[model samples]
Target: MQLVVGRIGRPHGLRGDVSVEVRTDEPEKRFVAGAAVATDPASAGPLLIESLRWHSGTLLVRFEGVNDRNRAEELRGTMLVIDSADIPPSEDPDEFHDHQLIGLAVLTPDGERVGEVSDVLHQGQDLLVVRRGKTDVYVPFVKALVPIVDLDKGILVVDGPAGLLDPDAIV
Candidate 1:
């Protein structure tokens, strides 16, 4: 399984260096010299990292064969992905990979089934995308909202606020 690690941003300079919008926490391990990562569109590349450096807190990478600014610009917005098998397990118990959360059943504190986790969005806040019927509900993945993650039981308990799970219900 391919997991997205980062997205190629704008070209940095006259050379084929592009800034990266990193999605993974282990950027140092994932983005390094001579690392080859797969691309999203499939046509862009299995880009080989010729070199990488941090420029003012931003990760800048130059891929092999991409020697000019135009070549780097062409790779803009390309998602850099690695095999899921390549990811090392987190030592922290609280840390859960997106793959680990994806198929887990979501339930209320009372054990009423709400949905199944379809995705986890990592924006400014982490949001769990729970699929209920044909629709998807975005639930904030915080301790107050999601108190329990019973991975062994394949379920997670949601301690949602009023009208959070059901909009039609009176607040």
Candidate 2:
């Protein structure tokens, strides 16, 4: 259960420093020195954080053994991950990770099976993209439209209007 935390950017200065686009909400608390994080597309080994700090709302990190501009440049665009077991528990029941909803089934309020959630898009608004046979539908994740999300049953009950799945319907 590895979760992505950040993405490494290009070298910032000559002191083996690289910018990171923090994806986690608590970046400062998560990217502490000596903490271990996995980097991708190399997923076999984990990178140890030697130092970390905030810079312009982004994270600046220096990893052990990567002490030069060239070394840091090579890690650009790599994603940082941590074991999901290390993630602190959340009190909010609705705050589910994107990975948890990837394969859940979607149904209408009337108990009609709609489709399976193929992907969760996080743009300006969160969207649950469903795939039904050959048809793909995008459903907004607003409470008014999605009233029930039964994770235990592996299904989400939506309350959208008629023709919401039609190609011409407003997304």
Q: Which candidate is the best by TM-score?
A: 1
Q: Summarize candidate 1's per-residue lDDT along 1-171 as a digit string, tens digits.
A: 888889999999998999999987578888889988899978999999999999898999999999999999999999998888877878988888887899999998899998899998888888999898887788988988998998899999998777787735655
Q: Model 1 reaches what TM-score against the true structure?
A: 0.81
Regions of candidate 1 where Cα sits further than 4 Å from its true position: 133-136, 167-171
* Residue-pair clashes, model 1: 0
lDDT of each: 0.89, 0.81
How well does each candidate superpose onto the true structure, as a TM-score?
A: 0.81, 0.77
| Cα RMSD (angstroms) for every candidate in the order listed | 2.7, 2.9
